[model samples]
Target chain A: MQQGPDKRFLLLTASLLAALLLGIIVATGMGYMAIGAGDILKIIASRLGGGEALLTDLEPTIPYVVLEVRLPRILTAALVGAGLAMSGVVYQGILLNPLADPYTLGISSGAAFGASLALFANMTLFGHFSTPLFAFVGAILTLLVVMRLSTFNGQISAQTLILSGVIVGAILSAGISFLKYLADEQVAIIIFWLMGSFAASTWQGTGLVAAALLVGLLVSLFFSRDLNIMSLGRRSSDALGVETARVRVLLLLTASLVTAVCVAVTGIIGFIGLIVPHLMRYLVGPDNRRLLPVSTLAGALLLLLADTLTRAVLPVEVPIGVLTALIGGPFFCLIFRQKQKARSYE
Target chain B: MSEQELFAIDQLSFAYGLRPVLDNISLTITPGRFYGIVGPNGCGKTTFLDLLSGGRRPAGGTIRFLGRPLPAYPKRQLARQLALVPQEFDTGFGFTVEEIVLMGRHPHIDRFASPGPEDWRQVDLALERIGIGDLRHRLTGTLSGGQKQRAVVARALAQNTPVLLLDEATASLDIQYTLQIFNLARLLVEDEGRTVVAVVHDLNLAAAYCDQLFFLRDGEIHRSGAVAATMTAETIAEVFGVTCQVGWNDFSQARQLSYRYRSHGGITAAPSPAGLGGSDGA
Candidate 1:
């Protein structure tokens, strides 16, 4: 019977969603100003029902700080978290590489280069919109270059794709460094942005990422079964009626666009995409249908936790990107080692 | 031999740029026959398999499926008719045996719909047929080579297509599993009247299992006929570039090919595919 994966998936979905809610409340409560969990819920509830505050016992400064300052940042972090993780699942599945993520195809470096160029030129042409727009364009262009390099005779090969990504990624990194060397006073700002942060998040940015993720996730789920067959390799998937070429291109573009938008907004958040899917695969197996949603929620919880720690728990703030790699690297290795040991028994 | 032609092909050619792997090949495939294509390494057997399965298209000439042109059929519709078990399967992912087998029902399952009870039943039946029912819960990545090969075969079997193509599907299997796959093919042909085309490396297995044999050499069909008549020692030597003995295994009531290193002086290299039985080079 299909009791095992089905039961585990349903249970896992419910629990992970519950965990996300708990994480949001707890993370929002754990900040420097110290808002209670109950208060966080009331503030969120008041906004949800579109009415005045249900519970107004908190100070005026706390509500303003929570809503005007922290909410946009927190929500954007959560949305970007989910979006990146979902794109990561897609990239890893389609490319047939567990090591793949939103950044594996050099999209992050491309975005970084674009953002750096914007900073170097001091182009406040679109006010807050200029850097993110350039970053989006850069990531998409990188995806196109990698895709073109990898494709041959109407088929895409994962081996060539990864190789092309590395090559292009190196070139983009050198470009970013050159731009950095040229930036006299703005180099520090460029470096800071490259480290990733949610300090300047806005509601519109959150909406943009949320919309991208919503559409991207639905498309990903629609083709999840084909993705499952694809892991068998190109020939088998084609033999199974997958229309491998079409699905591969469609999923590739969808995932890359999602990653582009997420990277554009968040300024190159690392490890969320890389780490979330692996952690979710262990908890729930690697079926993309289950993996996509679970990993997304886990990503939101994880980034929120990371952002909260950097913003509130620590005396001095650390870059969210650095924090993730530092924490995620060792824990991922430990989990991977244990996973390998468990797998050897099978 | 008035069997219905399921595939009617003429002047089929395929190439990677200018280097042609399959050139000006023509053949008729009849229903309910187990056909084998075999020759030396890089004989374009895999390439031919890919073309017939529609994983690749013919660079020149035409292939008609049933009565219509091969390209006329939609990809999903074509898949509903023909299924292939590839030579190699990547097991790096963590899909379970059951989940993998269930993927075969994709042609029948709608895009938005998950597999239903009936689909699972078919998957279970295929697993049972391939004798992998007990390993249904196990991860495909964790399976041994032979077991993984069987799982791959099971996925094809689960597709339940009218035409099945196996590209060295049993290459990694044990002797027993090899025989088992052949038997299953024979059963599908005899009992269900399904057409099967397998690219076999083993000469003897081709002899015993396949009713029809196509011996390819240098991208052309060297010989194509009933297996017993087609797989002669001279034909084998000419096509494969080696000497071999053909004898009957009375218990199995089928011919067997045995290789010997001693060079044969009787058969010179066949200049063209037409020179299989005669000395005429053109």
Candidate 2:
């Protein structure tokens, strides 16, 4: 007797994701030293085949730009996007607040501070290892601090949580500023890092990001039912056989790890983490079984598209962070306005 | 009543910070009995419900379910036996009524397992039982207060537990809805032979429907017994700090209560026994 809405939301999300991926690949191929779709495929096929034939025919710079440079950057964007979006979904579910995003818990600022410290200290012992590790550590520490500060009598009130997050974020930002002040005269590196860029995107960065994203997304799916119950409120969830506090702590730790890894690789690329999950929620509803996977795919597509635009739309090359903030700012305002309208009706 | 005790609280005491909410209280509920817990606000009715439902651990003493300590039974096992319909819940996401009700199957379903036909059948039956079957496809957020309360009760009923605990299950509902829910509870007790415990504020409703009533005062059981014996005017006035007259109505075969307000330095007059005889005329 219970035949739900016959329309399948999954098919819609999948088709949209496929279209976005195709659009991104085509758009990225249209950069200054344009590679035709046929050549792009040929190069990819040749590389997969472990042959250097495609490289022999192409202009020396073309393969380097497409395969070595832009491909890793695009993959990095997608990985970071998926990770951030997964974190955003988990954070929002745990907080039971729609306004919650990855940054709301200070994870982003903490990672940024860690990266800044790495830059200032000139920690080149293990090359790229120091930055990501420090970022992950910093994010987890910030999460712990915020959790400890907000808790009162074993319950974390909404007001105290938000306040603690803001306070922690402010402190992390101050730390980042301190690092910037101590930075060498070569201020371009600091500025670029702060504004966020994909200039340093590499195979190693993409691999790290992909690993973190996959693990985080998988773990979150396992806890999807708990998250669904948590959205109902802590007391009800507890009554429903969910260990609310333990589940919440695990979710926060997992989300923070993902956010830290993403921020470490690509600074603070805003909006994808905040908006992708929200859009997915609006489209597919709040069933996390659908929400998490769809949000991950949508987040990947969005960042890839944004990265493509950043490369294709300008002559001097735009930082991805600038593009994301510019796009996300308007989208955030639009959503805020819609929420206000909805609230007014209530 | 069945000899099997569904829930037993032994010298249970709980406090919020410095103030004790439940103080050295002990009670036992048996199978197939309709138990009504009534008390003034801040008198520990809800706290006692919480203890029974495993929502709170008592600071002192112990709670046992089915001859075993509550902590010994795994959470899911305990949930399988006892279902709670909380007073209020806020759900931000808009789950359809059918979907929300189906969550009651959580304790029964295995991890990563999809709901089978049996689950859906239970959900449909629950919705039908609550008389909200037509509203199954509607979002829970759009439901009225009474409908929401019914939906929650439907969820609890869907759990298929032998025992049910409700905290003010009909507090915000209209008279019609309140009667409907109480009638459903009565059916569960009489027809299904399940143990139903509810904390109700309306004394008349409790007296009219419940087989037994438990009156709580200051976290302790002030009085408890058959409804007629426990719901006298003296106990009501003493527990609630309000003057009320308890009477019987033969037309409805129900006990009724009429409340009176007392002014300063005024002596409250006792209800006359002749007024009790008016039940025959009605």
Candidate 3:
């Protein structure tokens, strides 16, 4: 009897993962350079095996473009998507709210504030990494402050945490606006960065997001069952032996960490975190054990496709954040409408 | 603390900030009996249940379960010993009836492992026991009020604990479902020797099913005894400030009570919980 859901989950996860792998292979070959799929696979195989001799047959520029120029950005986009979606699953589960996402706790705003300050000051402390470093710090600090404000004698109420995030986010947003006003000529750079993109992605950025996503996924899946029981409200979960407070804190912190790392690397990619889990939930049911993994795969594929469209398919490169919202908003509406109609019919 | 006592509450006291809810209450719950906690609104019946279920620590008391301090037991271990069915469940998520019942096996299942065949068997048995077998795959949100309550009770049944605590679980159900729930609890006590502690607002229903009754008033136990011993007109008036006549009902073979308001010439402005029994005030 239980095999029905489990089999469906396994089949869904396998197909999505296969699709993601196929996407990566195809996406790495696309762009103005137009590397062939076979050459792309050879390049990846040689690089992974640490055998440069296998790649000498191709033009030198082709290897450089495939490995140094394109591969990092593609992997980074996928990883960031996966991280954001996984964190979204945790956020929605812990808050027991459909609207919650990775950025719901003001983490994105905090990162934006830090990036704005660095841009406004024309900082070059860490060369190209200066703004991202600052943004990461700002996100972590905001998370700490929100947690502190929400904690009353070591208990964090979901409602209080959200309210605290809104309060802090509003203040930080005002600060960003003031900085933008003062920038004069520099405001365009700030606005573009806030719009979010993966153009500046490097191997190091890819590695960072991948590492965070792996750890976050493991932690999330481990406590996914406990997360399901938490939706029963605090008292029943406590009676069911979920240790609600401890599990909530652990998952919240872990999710925030994953989200901070992703935002630091990608600037401010939106929609994937908020929409992927919801979409997956519709297909997979609300069992977090199934929903979390499937959403991660779907997110990785979705953002990969989006980034590919901007980088190669489109006449001009559009910000990944803007594209996601533009596309995701409508698709989400369609699903919502369809679901509502189905319920009414029932 | 005797080994036979399931819960021994000593000087239990609780307060919602400055305002007291339960004060200096002492009670003991033995195994293999149906206990109905009856009280008017704001009389701390729910709080007493909360204390027993370890949802809240008493402000000034010691609650011992199985001869050990309640807090000393680990959360999962405590769940294996006792289960609680709340008033109602509300969620925006779509969890099937089977999934909800399987959650009762949480304490038994390991964190890294999924529910095994045995756990699924328990879920099936619980569903059958609660007469919800046909609705196993249905989403809980789509269930009727009575069906949802039965599903929740089935969850507790799946927990397979020695004791079950219900906090006004049938308050929203119709009379038929209410009687069905009470009958289920009575079966657990009579056939399985499981302890059932329920917070009930209906006096006659409590009298029919519960072996022992505890009436609470002003955060204290106003009376506690068998229905035949403690149920009377004077006790009802003192605890609830309403007049009632206690009589036996042959159909149910249990003591029944009919409530009436005290004659005050005209309706008073003060709010009362009990409704008018007849057009002519007693």
Candidate 4:
């Protein structure tokens, strides 16, 4: 598949955006307190326009639950999914490895380790913000270390980078395990956070994630051409005037930072970063410019759908992270096998 | 030759870590000439090409491109002036042949800009020139080795730079593609007035195509000049450690290098020019 912005691509993009909006409206109707899609849209429109409530026939508590409570959680999950998917597209493109994701470079585990340590230490230095702050710092530092370890004679080899990520990730994971062993009372808290959930989501947290994602996606799209060149490997990119060192380091930091913020906020949401890019790539192609938007929408939809299924469809509510793994795992294999034979597509 | 020098390299040297790969090399490259650097493995031919194209920095001395210091130009500007057809790459992405060729337009297209109609025309011309226009829609990863090699060269051609570099670029191509690539290089040099410096593994092709030759051995230049002057059997033996007869074929009127078994330099024999005069047309 080659990257092109054709009519079909435009159609798919519009359809995916529409699907995401529909999914959100449908998702808000779940969780014991059912609400109609028309009423949900009216409530959202009334709040967004700062106007009078158009659906006064609906109970005010329904608006409160949808706007103040459920919307924050649902929107946060959607933004985190989009952010992680954007990071995945960047990671895979820059690293020149199809298997690369937010987790492949160990940024997530680094964030997890730092967050776990903060949980055990009962860090209140930044009040409610301390754990996420620690996680962000840990992820940035690990990215620098991984880049340093992979560089040889001013060149960063993909194989070396992957190896460095694995080794560093192993060490950080061990450190996390040791922190778990040391924690006596907060162990359950740490475990649940690691399992990932949006139950604690607030409007403020959703706003933070939304702002981060907006900036990150714009930055990713800005470097989309250079990322395309980078797929040819380092020397070819350089020869094409990509300034491989500068572009690689810039995109690496941008993607890794976005991934860090997502992991810090959500504990550890899996599969969105790994699976969304592939799914969108199969639909569109490998062109970062074309793939980014569709992947973002697809990711938001996938996670929102998974979150909805776990929140209401399942008899016993499971963590969103567990639900994604269960659903995305088989879906990935099926799509991968199916796409293998249809690749002459435009 | 325009009496204008494209590259004026003086005492240029480079090393990988503690080991020197190019040492005290000085050369002048004029515009519109096909220059070939040939040597045995580990003789650092590729390293020399790398330095000339500004892919690798020289450890010492100076290289002036078009009368300006090489490093003074930003990478993007330098790329517009020089392009490199690197050795066969392991493309890890699923970029199509057209997309891969389109990357050569990066030097012309701005970061925020897309490839316009003119740019697409150039890419199409490059694909056609490389004789792969029909396969433009094919994914590069699925191409045969020779097709991939041509696609890489086509990308360099698409760049439309003033100077082009090749690092054993045709070593993997079949004989037909190899000849086609050499012809393209010559046409680029003569008709388009573009300077080309290539590191070639095929000694015979290098002799026939290259206007000038540089022989490297032990991290130093053994000889440099017109192909006929430096491609002698004695120099080939001294540099490549192979005994070869160097002569011009009367049919094609192009110089040729032929290998023959020989004892050590203890016995010297005159080169026999037989069965090589007619146009073999390979």
Candidate 5:
């Protein structure tokens, strides 16, 4: 009898993994100079370990565009999506609020402010890596501040955490706006970064985001059962032996690190983190044990498709961030309405 | 501390900053009996239960469970020995009833291990015992109030602990379901040798179900003993500021108490001969 749901969950996860793989391959094949699916797989295989001899026959520019440009951008987009969505799952579970996401704790605003300052001042202390480093620092500091502000006598209340996030986030947003006003010649650079794009994605950025996603996924899955019990609220989860305070802090720090890495790499790509987990919850239910992995794959697929649409299908390039919100905002509204209707019936 | 005592609370004092909730309260809970903590609205009944479950630390004193200080035991080990059924819960995400019950196995299962066959058997037995086996697949949020409370009780049962603490766990249920929970608590104590402590609002229900009753007034145990001796009309009037008639009920074979508000002073009449007419239906 219990086999029914587990089987369905297994099938869903398998299908999602397949879909993500297909999405990445198909998306890599799309661009101004379109490559065939066969060549795309060959390039991926050859890059993995098949040796340079396999790619020797391909046109130099084809390999260059696919490997040097499109692949890095595509992989970064997918990994950022995965990290955001996974962190979103942890945040929502920890806070016990559906409206929560990776950015609910103001990590995005912190990253944006850091990047904005770097751009405005032309700080090249870290050479090409300066802006992202600043963003990472900013996000970590913001998380620390929020954690400190919310924690009272070693316990972090969910309501206080969110309140602190909003307060800090609002101040940071204002700071970013002030920086934008001060950045006369560099205003375009600041604006573009704030708008968010994957056109500048590189192998190093992809590697960094990938490493973060891997760590985040492992930690989240380890605590998924405890996260489930935590939905019963603090007192009850404590009674159930969850060690709620320790688990809550560890998960919160892990999730914030993942969000910080994603933001530092891809700028603020909202909505994917906020909506992908919710969408997958509707399909898979809210057991984070199943929900986290499935949502990770689905988030990767959704963002890859969105980036492909903006990069290949659209005549003029629109910021991928704008495209996702445009697509996700309405989809979320639909899900919310359906949920309300279902509850009314109950 | 006696070997037979499940909990030996020694001068346990808790406060909310300066305002004391439970002050210098001491009690010993023994195995194989049902204990009820009854009090007025703000009489620290829930706080006392919280202390026993190790949810809160006593400000001034100590609580020893099974001859060891409560804090000395690792959380998971302690959870394996005891379980708490809370009064109100929000299953924030729409987890299924089975999933909720399976959480009872948390302390028993290793951190990395999933629930095995034995865990499933326990969950199934708990669901069956709570009479909600058919509702296992349904989402907890979709269940009615009484059904949700029953699922929570089943979760506690699945924990398979030696001690069960209930903090007004039946306040929302209708009389029928309320009686069902109390009866289940009694069965667990009498047959399984589990120690059960409940914070109940209904005096007659506590009297009917619990082997030992602790009456709390102003954060102190005003009276504590066997139900027949501790549940006098004078105790009820002093603790609750109301007038009650205590009598024997032949139908249920339990001491029953019926109360009327002192504010309604004009309507003085002989105590209703139908003593505890409401609980008789159960």
Candidate 6:
């Protein structure tokens, strides 16, 4: 009898994930004028099955948009979503705070600064490779600074970590604004990049982001038991022979690495990381073994759906980040309300 | 079998930054003995337990277990021999009671290995031993304070370590649960012949259950010996600064220490009513 509900829940989760993926593919395919679901599937099948003539037979413009344009954007959305959610799980686990997200520790601001600097100076290094490399470096440097500042007298309190992150984030934001001031008439490009978009996404960029996110997620899953112990609080975890400080440092570095890669590839896509894990926790419970994987899949689906909406909602393409904020802000308020109700009873 | 010290702390000293929490503390715990540490709050009792458990390194002295330096032992190996039941834990996750208990077997588990049938059996037995078997499937967060303490003890029991260190594991528990945990610790000592060391705040509980007692005051050892010799009213007054009387309880087969009200100006008369079996008026 007990197994019945557990099995049903698992089945429901798997079906929901599959349905979401299919819905994103269909919605993205329907965005263009010439393409339909059937034609999109035929093109995808012909390309995947290595049938060149069958793929070429589809409308020239249709295949180009479906394969080259929409596909890369959808894929990038999925990668960024996964990266953000994985980092969220790691940060929340290590800090033992549910509100911890990748961006909460100033990683996004650091990435913004790096990207803006690249844009303002026309840095050839950031151009040759993806901007993510510079963003990754900037994010890591900021994380190191925040960690050093937070560790006063050889101890890191939760309050100190949060405060340091806020201060450093403000500093980095100011630096980005300075870069914008120095930027020429090309400042519009810098401004749009800061706002975040999927317009510049490519298959190569999507692939790199996906690989980095996959590595991060796999490593986190392997250490799920350690993460579980960490949620018990640091002192008790250390007493249990966990080497708490070492675990926290490793997790923070890994989460930052994932965040830098994602933010560099697709500007700051907000709320998926912050809200997806919170929702998944309420749905499937807070066991990291289940929580991490479920959140990754759910986040990917949410971002893909949101990106599809961005393309379909207006004749002109809306920035994916704007849509996420517009939708996520109200969702965030709902979560706060729920939390308030829960706190009242407690 | 001739001689083996399970734990030996020699001139161990530690401080938080530079505050000097523990100073020149030397003690030895042998196999199959129940040792109790009693001290006033902020007297470095918990810090001493933390040092012995390898959670903190002593600034001055050495700690040896099984004739090897404490730091030399690999973390997993040391965990196999010693298990610590902390004073309080929130356990803020969705782990079941059985799952929490089974974590004690982590040291014995190999990488990527799942718990075996024996591990599950041991966890079941531990829950049963702690008398919380019925709550096995319940989430740890939903349990009451007494139940949570029992679950933690169950986790330590499942560890199956030879030496157990409990740092006020019963502080927040009710009297019944407190006695229950003490009785369980006694059973481990008597039946399994395990060495148990507890940092306890209650003096009576220490006198009743501890085979040996160590009293700490201001980061220094005030007294140490068999319970009958070290738990006298004079020693209690000297260490705790309380006027108390000591007597034997025939029914419980243990010593009992009772404290009297303070006299004027915190001074008491000679042959005061603090003595056991004395009249209301001295």
- Give the per-residue lDDT digits (tens) of candidate 2, residues A276-311: 888887777888878888888888888888887777
Of 3 and 4, the candidate ranking higher by lDDT = 3
Candidate 3: residue pairs that collide = none
Better of 1 and 2 by DockQ: 1
Better of 3 and 5 by DockQ: 5
The alpha-carbon RMSD values of the candidates against the true structure, listed in the order shown, are 3.9, 5.9, 4.1, 5.5, 4.9, 5.5
Q: Which docking band does candidate 1 fall into?
A: medium
User: Which of the two, 4 or 5, has more DockQ?
Assistant: 5
Query: What lDDT is reached at residue A35 by model 5?
Result: 95
TM-score of chain B of 3: 0.90
lDDT of 3 at B109: 93
Q: Tell me each candidate's TM-score.
A: 0.93, 0.91, 0.94, 0.93, 0.94, 0.91
Q: Candidate 1 vs candidate 4: which has greater lDDT?
A: 1
- Residue range B181-251, candidate 2, lDDT tens digits: 89988999999998889998888889888998989877778898998888898898777766767899786
Docking class of 6: acceptable
Docking quality class, candidate 2: acceptable
lDDT per residue (tens digit) for residues B43-116 in model 4: 67777877887777899999998888887878889889899988757555677888888989998997788688
Query: Candidate 1 lDDT, tens digit per residue, A1-346?
Result: 6577789989988987898777767777666688987777778787788466575676767767778788888888888899888988999998899888866788888888889999999999999899999899989989899999998887788888889998999999999999999999999989998998898898999899999999999999999988887888888888888888899889999998988888788788888888899988987888888899898888888898889889988999999888988998898888778877877534
Candidate 6 overall lDDT versus native: 0.79
Q: Tell me, by DockQ, which candidate is best.
A: 1
Using DockQ, rank the candidates from best to worst.
Answer: 1, 5, 3, 4, 2, 6
In terms of lDDT, the best-performing candidate is 5
The regions of model 6 sitting more than 4 angstroms off are: A1-9, A128-130, A152-159, A181-187, A339-346, B1-3, B262-282
Report lDDT (Cα) of residue B140, candidate 5: 83
**DockQ (Cα-based) per candidate?**
0.56, 0.37, 0.47, 0.44, 0.51, 0.34
What ranking emerges by lDDT with the best candidate at the front? 5, 3, 1, 4, 2, 6
Chain A only: TM-score of every candidate? 0.95, 0.92, 0.96, 0.93, 0.97, 0.92
- Candidate 6 residue-wise lDDT at B139: 79
Residue A63 alpha-carbon offset, candidate 2, angstroms: 2.9
Worst 10 contiguous positions by lDDT, candidate 5 chain A = A337-346
Sum up the clashes in candidate 6: 0
Interface RMSD of 2: 2.3
